[model samples]
Target chain A: MTLLTSAVAAIVCTIIWYKNAPKNDMKIGILCWMYWGATIMWFVDAIFEYAELKAEYFSPAPADMLNDFFLGLSVVVFGLIIWLVILLIKDPKGVIKSALSKKAN
Target chain B: MACFLISTAEAVVTTVAAKQIEKNENLREVNVSEVKYSHKTPFSKKLKWLRNMLWGGSALLLFEHVWHGEIVPFFPFLTAASNPADAAEMLHEMATVGVTMALLVTGVWGVIVGITTAMEKKAEKEDAAQIAEHAEN
Candidate 1:
């Protein structure tokens, strides 16, 4: 379930970035590749994690691991989002502005 | 927060130095100058790169956690004992997310660079055309 959510989020974000990319900008394509690559890796990792968790079903380790993982991931994602926002804000000449301006036009 | 602050400071310094050079080139119509500034020093460059890597790595680690159903807290704000399997999963998610975020940032940066390049080219072409017209006249 967690994997599905993360995959969905990643795909959605990628699509959003792609659809909004400027006509002349090639970076959006790169972003698409990166997002998809990360998503694939996440899926693989999740499978392995699940298998290991199952093996340790009798222990509380699984639950503890799950909590820590979520907390850490959340922080990272939030941080990334913040960084993106800051970059856009600091550099109006950035891709986000270009994309938005082009859209406006 | 500390990491963000440090990275932001580094970014600001780098951007300022680069932007200054860009501005000088645009305004003076002079050849580019190469000066060894602190911001452009090897140590500074390495620090900037390391910051980027750490951020990207963290994102990937987060994703691994999300994938393994560890995204939600098990104890609901309570700290629990460590579990290697869970920890491994979490680490993977973090690293995955970190990488993904880094890629996204790079893509955005590329777009910005492209835009700037286009603008510069357009300006240069315009100047050349004007000069040609003046010569013909």
Candidate 2:
């Protein structure tokens, strides 16, 4: 479930990154990298867990699935937060820079 | 059980290395007078890409382990560490899954750096061609 979530996030972010490839202002590529990296990690984790659980890996408890879903969502949120911080620091679009200058005036 | 720790440890080491490299690069820049090219991103910045990916993935995985009670806040830290059987299993997972994940991420990062470096090279070539054309005119 975590792998699925990260894969979805990676796909969505990759699309965004592709669309904005020319402008490159959003730095969406970083988000894509982060999500895809996580997806790969979770994929390996799932494989190991499945090796241990065997047939039972398919039948996760409902509560466990729910918890995993929440975990996945929170991971996405955290990735976005990190991206936001990078954007603010880099200010690729100069949005923060302009805002700060405006405030100074 | 604690497979993600491998990547987390690598991230910590790389993060410190990146900082040190950046500091050294800054000092080098101050001591040298060199023509600056616009498209060349620093190596330290590129290293940050790996750091960010590893750190982000490790953090999420750590949180997941904690949520699942595989990790504890107490002494041993890892619940598996307190048990002999589970400790062996945990070490096996670390050797296989953990090491694989870290290697895969680093490999992917290598590809990314290669692509970006190629792109920068192409851009530099184009700039040189334009300059030569202007000189000819």
DockQ of each: 0.07, 0.53
Q: On residues A1-105, what C-alpha lDDT tens digit does candidate 2 reach at each position? A: 888998999999999888877777888878887888798899888887889899999999999898888989988888899889888899988888899999999
Each model's chain A TM-score:
0.44, 0.94
* Residue B136 Cα positional deviation in candidate 1, in Å, after optimal superposition: 34
The per-residue C-alpha lDDT of model 1 at residue A42 equals 43
Q: Per-residue CA lDDT of candidate 2, range B22-124, in tens?
A: 9998998998887576687899999998998898788778877887899988989999999899999999989999999999899989999999999998999
Tens-place lDDT digits, model 1, residues A1-105: 334444555576567676876652333333333344344444544554557688563355677657745654564465456446555566645767688899999
Model 2 accuracy (lDDT, Cα): 0.89
B1-137: candidate 1 lDDT, tens digit per residue: 01122223434565466556556546644453654222122233333333443333334544444444444556431121156565565456445543444444445545645665677677777877887999999
Error of 2 at A3 (Å): 0.7
**Model 2 pairs in collision:** none
What ranges in model 2 sit over 4 Å off? A17-30, A49-67, A78-105
